[model samples]
Target: MKYLSLIIMILMSPSCSISKKNASVVKEKLIVTFSKGKCLGNCPVYDLYIYNNGRVVYNGIDNVKKKGVYETLIALDTVKRIEYLMKHFSPEEIGNTNGRDIPFTILKINDKKVVYRSTRSSGNLLKINNLIENIKDKL
Candidate 1:
């Protein structure tokens, strides 16, 4: 009888799997767009945020910092743009990420997107203009 009680106690303990709480965390994807490194024209630096729930948030040019940091929510309303960004940028930079994937901050889109390449590949400026141009076709 005592052994049965001990087994029951162990099963009912806080550390038991039945007592554990399920995680409520949700993963999200975000894209940060740019016109120039430091703002050169009317092209607004856009940041498109994409949620796993099919929801999106947009941050336009006005909210962007004057020095040139920009980000906004990606619009699901336009599947063309979303598909373009995901298909191209994913293989080029890091795909539809949660924004913590890369190190460098100055994301530019003038002639091309200059992603900070890794040190092993010489850490040099990896010019992705061609890829961007190809993606531009889809846009």
Candidate 2:
């Protein structure tokens, strides 16, 4: 009886909200940020922030087609992708040593931050980055 009561209490606690089966129903505020630093070569220098509320903010600093702040909304598919990443992908995968580069890329999802200096990136991370670049390019 005591073990059962303890298990019930744990499930009822606030900390269990995220890993629960109903996480999608109780979705938290999601914020994904991507920033790239300058390199000896002219690499794109900018910061991009994506929020679960469908708002996308991009700040183009230097070496890009555009140099300004831009904001827009993202598609529902993008939001779902981000939520999946935040829920499953480990920190090591984000900082995975695929290749090296002169510039550094910083990607932050909620509290986790991955800073990598790589010339190439693959997977959903790459797709999200491309989305940021496209948005900045049009502005």
Candidate 3:
């Protein structure tokens, strides 16, 4: 029994040390921001910020369900999924078109940034819109 206990402790020590080492590696903060412009008709204009800690802030400017600043906490899993999506996003995946009246989406992933403006609606914009709605629903 003594030998068995010693062997178990020895096996557990390495994993504990490994986990501590991994925990020491600081992860970069993830932030997602979305903003929209006014259109020809009544369009909601808002600026939203989502942090890795699951804190979200939405500033509604005009024609929105809620006006002024509102803050809420989202699920950590949702934040992780958003981080994954932003990290994998590519500028080449979305094309730009001339549309002055349409809303523009500015997505920033860490230090990288992309502005999306489409005359004819695209899948990327739809994805972003859906993300915005999801975040709002949580709030």
Candidate 4:
């Protein structure tokens, strides 16, 4: 009986409590990502990842004010708004291009991916650009 009590106490100790690390490890899946490609001129090249848990990560490579890696936790409302925008726009409709000189924008949602390499950006691409800017502002 004493040995059983000791084992139960050990199991219920704070040290054996749910680990924060383990909880964080179960992160929300990737919701959307926007990647800016290099241009002939000094255009900011970076990748932005928006996770379902309202976690945003920006990795800036060159010609940008915010360089290096940046992480921000956005509000749940913002996360929902982004998800709505992505669903409404529908990435599958955007066609892929191979414009090397002009800057390109890559928008991805789960398995569906779209790359916009047009110099004259419009329609859904413009909305995506606006969405990225809105996210950046929030961050």
Candidate 5:
């Protein structure tokens, strides 16, 4: 019975082996970051919105007053995938959750892999289309 349980665990482990041919067909999550622009009277922490194929999936804004508030907005096809990631990955601290531009970190990917933008990608914001194009072949 111990051996049987071990076998089940091994088989249930996450897999990240999507063939190049099928990578495009798989539903992958999209994580995008927006800049928390400079302040005038009160710094506006830009809102975070996750849109999949032009449809909104999750929308949350940060309400912090500090400048340079980084926020991550994640868009996945299913809530189960998001929950799985939230359980596995540790997220960054969000200065504000009610205003706009709440930064986020990748918690986990269901397939054990994800395609996201690098933090040092030129400007503060990373293009979603560019990220998708960069990881489409890898899935």
Candidate 6:
């Protein structure tokens, strides 16, 4: 009976799945991915990703000042602000809102997402996009 109890206690203890050496290799969860499509004129076309580790990855496709893939890092707090913005002011937009001359973008988080073609977004959603823009400038 004592042996059984000891074994149970050992198994229930916090299992150290991430060791110290391997800790650095474990990346935070992917929080968001934004993809922008081109328009009739010079509009930036790219894809951006944000991870909880404050890592940002940007892939500029065409018609943008920056071209090619670039990776940059930001503060964890900024990433958290992004999380808050996403939760508090998620856009209800479901379809393309602007004409063909304007660009469209898809912003995804977890299982939910919103797509819009409007030149701008509403509320804190615009802040989220602004944050992404700042991330890209760092790259």
lDDT of 3 at 11: 81
lDDT of each: 0.36, 0.71, 0.72, 0.75, 0.35, 0.79
The alpha-carbon root-mean-square deviation between model 6 and the true structure, to one decimal in Å, is 5.7
Q: Give per-residue CA lDDT, model 3, range 43-90, as digits (tens).
A: 778888877777789998999888899999888887777667666656
- Tens-digit per-residue lDDT, 1-139, candidate 5: 9999999998887566645546755553443322233333443334332333322222223444322323333344433343343344422311223423322333222333322223323221133323432222122
Best by TM-score: 6
Error of 1 at 33 (Å): 7.1
Top candidate, metric lDDT: 6
lDDT of 1 by residue, 1-139 (tens): 9999999998777763433443323243334232222223443344433343334443444424343332233235443443344345543343332333333323443234444422211211222332322222333
Query: Model 4: residues >4 Å from true position, as ranges?
Result: 1-20, 90-100, 137-139
* Candidate 2: C-alpha lDDT: 0.71
Candidate 3 whole-model C-alpha lDDT, 0 to 1 = 0.72
Candidate 3: worst 10 consecutive residues by lDDT? Answer: 117-126
Q: Write the per-residue lDDT of candidate 6 for residues 1-139, one digit (tens) a residue.
A: 9999999999887657746546766656788999988888888899999888888888999987888888888899998898888888844533338575877778888776878764557677777777877787778
In model 6, where do residues sit more than 4 Å from their true spots? Answer: 1-26, 90-96
How far residue 121's Cα lies from its native spot in candidate 5, in Å, is: 21
Model 2 steric clash pairs:
none
- Give the TM-scores of the predictions, in the order they appear: 0.28, 0.62, 0.67, 0.72, 0.22, 0.75
Model 4 local distance difference test score: 0.75
Stretch of 10 with least lDDT, candidate 1: 117-126
Where in model 3 is the C-alpha error above 4 Å?
Answer: 1-30, 118-128
By lDDT rank, best first, the candidates go: 6, 4, 3, 2, 1, 5
Clashes of each: 11, 0, 0, 0, 12, 0
Model 2 TM-score? 0.62
User: Which of 1 and 6 is the better model by lDDT?
Assistant: 6
Cα lDDT of model 2 by residue, 3-31, tens digit: 99999998787775456857764563547
